[model samples]
Target: MNERVLTPRNRGFLFLDSHPAGCRQLVADMWEACPAPAVPPAGDRPVALVIGSSAGYGLAATLAGLKRAGVRGIGVSFEKGPTARRTATAGWYRTAATADIARAAGRDLVLLNGDAFSDAMKDQVADLVERRFGGRLDHLVYSVAAPRRTDPDTGAVHASVLKPIGRTNRTKTLVFDEEGAPEVREVETAPAEGDDVEQTVAVMGGTDWERWIDHLAGRGLLADGFSTAALSYIGSSLTAAIYRQGTIGAAKAHLEATARVLDERLGRTVGGRAVTSVNGAAVTQSSTAIPGIALYTGLLRGVLGDGLVPPVHQLAALWDQLTGAAPLDLDADGRIRLDGFELADDVQAAVAERWENARTATVADLADLDWFRDEVRRLHGFSVPGIDYTAPVATDVPWPGHTL
Candidate 1:
């Protein structure tokens, strides 16, 4: 692919030949183009830091923290390279938009591109907190979704898998990429090993969550009455075997477990609390890649469209909780169940019935599902409004504060 072809479809230009500088200019231009929105500054206007903050729930969380809570200065840690065949990562384009949004809102935003799991990155965050905002962060949102992680204690790298246990559960999925509409294709299965489960837990679990909190506390970057939360999800039983019961489920369980650890640790401080928001299923780059989920999402989309709650609304609710405007209710496992709408017994039962019957769902039946598909594609800087796709985009765009 041509390097210039990598620029986002919506705004600005990306020159591959000078990727670093181009990315930076793109970010700067986005900042310059932001629209100023009037928002009331509340309670000292805390500094918010978002990890995995480039796209999807992470980006939504960042926006909520700023627009809702009147957070002024922001820091984001995202993983995307300057030049790659895949073009700029969704997070890269999102940061540009986010910076633009913040600037338009008359807020200051700083973005850092790096591994959020690193000590160096943590230190960089701490220094920023100390220097810019007086070592006080009112809200911290952890929204990283990774397929692998290096065990800090063992120094071993673990990769997560997506497979079911016990038997081969074949399922049909709709091929939206085809112009001819939904085509059914049977998906093969793979049995997950014990190591797969364990490694998935290691990679997706709460160890890193704890580390971020610990490092922040140790560095004295945590402000009084600080609130922190992470995102989690649980789909229907149709996906339980592959999702909730498989490697990813193991990791989610670990993530829920980490919330308690963090709460306990942060509670020792003044008015500090850790929370886990169990989010509803939405189309995201990570979620779409999960097997058997696309069909379910499509069907559920149409079913829930009349009364379904969007992820942005859910995130806004989370922000409400963070700012003490709403009560923090915990489930039996001490985690927030924001997916209550989807997890409703009737909802899952309906989807499960469709799954069991193996009915061929058409695009009209899955129109709601397209929202997420479009959003995910937009995250990759494709299919967005206002950009001419025919024009070549430069790949070598300089990202502000992006360190290789």
Candidate 2:
């Protein structure tokens, strides 16, 4: 085994290396932090498939289903494994650790590492459902976040961008100065040009979700009352111009529309359901790359304090909804709103005030920059508490489940 005390190699918001031991600790921490279900699940050994299930809300949802809902989960993600010289992706380590945890708890949690948008990947997952999980899919959670996708039919590559739709946006964003201190600065983002919206929707929208459902249904893999949820976000007006009104929002709108279509079709055919669950913003790899989200989430964490709903809690409630233990609190648009606490009137008011007056001098006071920084580091398997960063750890860790 190759051993080294790995440190993070980063450029701005992007991280290039991950610590395997730290990722394991993060997964363990999440398992402990996640709350148990309010009541027992309705189904026995319910089978679930979580796409993008290595990190962020996907990972949380996977753990929630296993620990809180007693699910047999199959997680699919595309992540790079470690080589002799380089460490594996954070998702890779997280998935490996999660598989081990599930084994220790006597739960069934198989993982697949590959391109989820590809037709071959879907076929492989369907086969697993049929052979390994009794040919019944109880839940399908889509939490995929990718910069680009290659269409299986057309073989055309589509790349998604984070930009406003019609107008250029100027927003106060969080940046790190030369001294590595947090600073709030004004950043200008140009509007989406040409087929930017189309490309973004192709990559981030529900077309792939529809394809997954159609494929599974065709294979007769959907169980009775099978439900699917595609994760989305509709933030407050503080980030409306760059988030809810931006190119990514266009994709989310399309996703929600597709959910309606799938919900109707599933209900009509097999008593199933579908929804776009608008989750609360938290520190995730994808969210940090957005223009205003870093600043918005920082302020949100500061204002909400203990009230902020983390992804694991939101997904655990989703498990309740899936298993008849709780009702799905759907909005007028037939979408699940998990971000209610973040969008509370008082919370928004406080955050708005902070947004207006926040500067480098008061950023720490106005926002939870420390938490934000720690969470970002934690995402890449750094800055996790109780982790021995000085000790050499094996970088070549193998996933403890099936890989594609």
Candidate 3:
């Protein structure tokens, strides 16, 4: 019986360990708090596949399908299991907990742990769909976020960078000072050099997503009227130079272009559709790692207060659009805009005003640093409510579901 109390270890933007019990509790809370869609999707119980379904927007999309749309789901993610020396990643515990909750609610949500970008993994999922899910997919959601990706065709490994495209980006960002306290400081990210843009697009772009659709569609997997969405973000001008106008932005643009291409192809073949859902900012692991995003989101919390939409709530709205319960609020480029509130004129004006006056000393007044810190801690199963952090818990908790 090996057990110990796991406290969070913060190493800059990373957490060293995750608490199994705390992560379970966090997932349970999210499942309970998620609001059901106004109207469930029509027809029989739908089937969905959510790639990168263990965390962030992917998790939200999974829950939206299972709980709101009454869909039996297959979730694909890459998560490291626990060992004697270290606990599993937060995502491992989250998936396990989600499986438990789904079973209790009489819903089916299968989790598959592996590199979803690989051809082998795609084949595995397609076979599973044939055996267990009626051989058709009603919806497919792509929300993978990773540092690097291996090209399944060329065996080339491409790594993504957070650098600006043409010029060095200097901006005020959140950092831990010498005292290990949150502080506002200016940081400079140098311009991308050489093949940085191409490499970034290779890693985070739409190529893999396109491959997934092609593989599934070729195998006659996508159902009639099927819908697919890939999550994206378009941040404000505050961090645009390092985010929306950076190498990652180029990758996102490629993603949007892929969505358009897929929409046309799917519509022609199966009467299906594909969209890039531009989501709002929230406290996600990927968001916190961006250079200026922590500062910008903190200011969002300070100014917007309760007006800011959480990820799950945004997903509920998305479910409505997907199910025809509401209209698809597409922007000019034919992408869904779930970020309207965050981009509203008044909200941006207030946040911009606060940004200009932000200094280390004045940051407390201008930003919700406590909320920012707590959200980061909460991501790794720390600082959760009603969790006995002092008590020991098992480290090697396996998901009580089939894994490949």
Candidate 4:
């Protein structure tokens, strides 16, 4: 038996456990939030499809479907299984763990690992739902985060790049090294050029989301009066140039636009509802990969502290609201604003003040750097309980009710 304690090897932290115990407090709170509603929704044992349902918001939403609404869920994602050389991606562990929880609660969870942007995956999902889930899925959750995508229609490949859309934006970024010290690194991002917005929109935009919904509708897979939502984000003005007002922002703008079109189409076609929920930003697998996000999240924590909500908490809350008696309110553009607290006037003012004071010498001091770092590790099943780090982890554990 090889003894090992996984440690941060670069910006990509690699420590993990096979059987991870997520935050005890979070698990407790989620149990409380998971409702046994007497008055179920309009459907029978609600059926749901969560695209990209492996990590971050997607994982949270999948949990909500099973634990909160008692919905039978089919989760689709592009995740890898563990190999002899390395542990599987956090998304893989998360999917298997979530399935275990769901099955224990007497709910059903089917996981499909594949390229969601591919037409072949879409066809497989439609066929599976038709054969197994009664050909009617009432909820569609779109929460994909990938660096590149293939256009299912045209076969054109688009890669998403993280670069400022205008004049260079310089700032201090948070980076961790092998020594486990969170250090501030200087970074200068140049303006995007040569069809950056087009390329980014092609990859991260709502095209694939629409294609999924449309193909499902054509196949009669979308149940009448069904609801669909895609997770989105809008944070402090400090990051607007690099985030909200940049290439990614352009892609999100297109997403919001597509939601409007889908909203009307669904409403007219099947009395269905479509929305884009602008969720609060948190440290996740993708957030670490994006330029300038770690600094912003760290600074955000300095101001928001516990006020900021993680995705698991956020998803549970949203599900409670959606299933409760009240109707959902939409902004002028017909988008749900889940990023309310994150965009609050007080929070924004505090983040701005902190951003102004942040520097290489004082960034760690100005922000909740420790929480930011730990949360990133937690996303990958590190800092979890009930694990013997000295023993070799079983990377190829099979999911409950699944043959792998």
What lDDT tens digits, residue by residue, belong to model 3 across residues 1-404?
66998887868869889988888888888888788656554677888899999999998888777777777869999999998788899999989988987888777778999999899999999988888888899888899898999999999999999999999999999987545587888999999999999999998989999999999988999999989999999989999999989999999999999999999998999898899999999998888888989999999999988888888888878877776678888989999999998999999999999999999889999988888888888889988899999999988888666643
What TM-score against the true fold does each predicted structure earn? 0.84, 0.97, 0.97, 0.90
- Cα RMSD for candidates in order: 5.3, 1.4, 1.4, 3.0
**Separate clash counts for every candidate:** 21, 0, 0, 0
**How does model 3 fare in lDDT?**
0.88
Each model's C-alpha lDDT? 0.69, 0.90, 0.88, 0.76
lDDT comparing candidate 2 with the true structure: 0.90
Per-residue alpha-carbon lDDT of candidate 1 for residues 1-404, written as tens digits (9 for 90 to 100):
34454433322112222222233333333333332234455556778887877656776677766676667655556656554555555456567656767778777677888778778888888887788778787788889888777766677888978877666666666555324344546787777866887887777888888898888888877888888998988878777877888778888888988898888878887568998989988767687778777777876776677466665567777877787777887888888788888888888777766665554444445445456455445545554555565666655445655321
Off by over 4 Å in 2: none
Residues 1-404, model 2: lDDT tens digits? 89998887787778888999899999998898888766665646899999999989999999988888889869999999998778999999999999988998888778999999999999999998888888999999999999999999999999999999898999999987645699889999999999999999999999999999999999999999999999999988989988889989999999999999999999999899999988888899998998878988999999987788878888888878876678878899999888888888898999999999999899999898888888898999999999999999998898775643
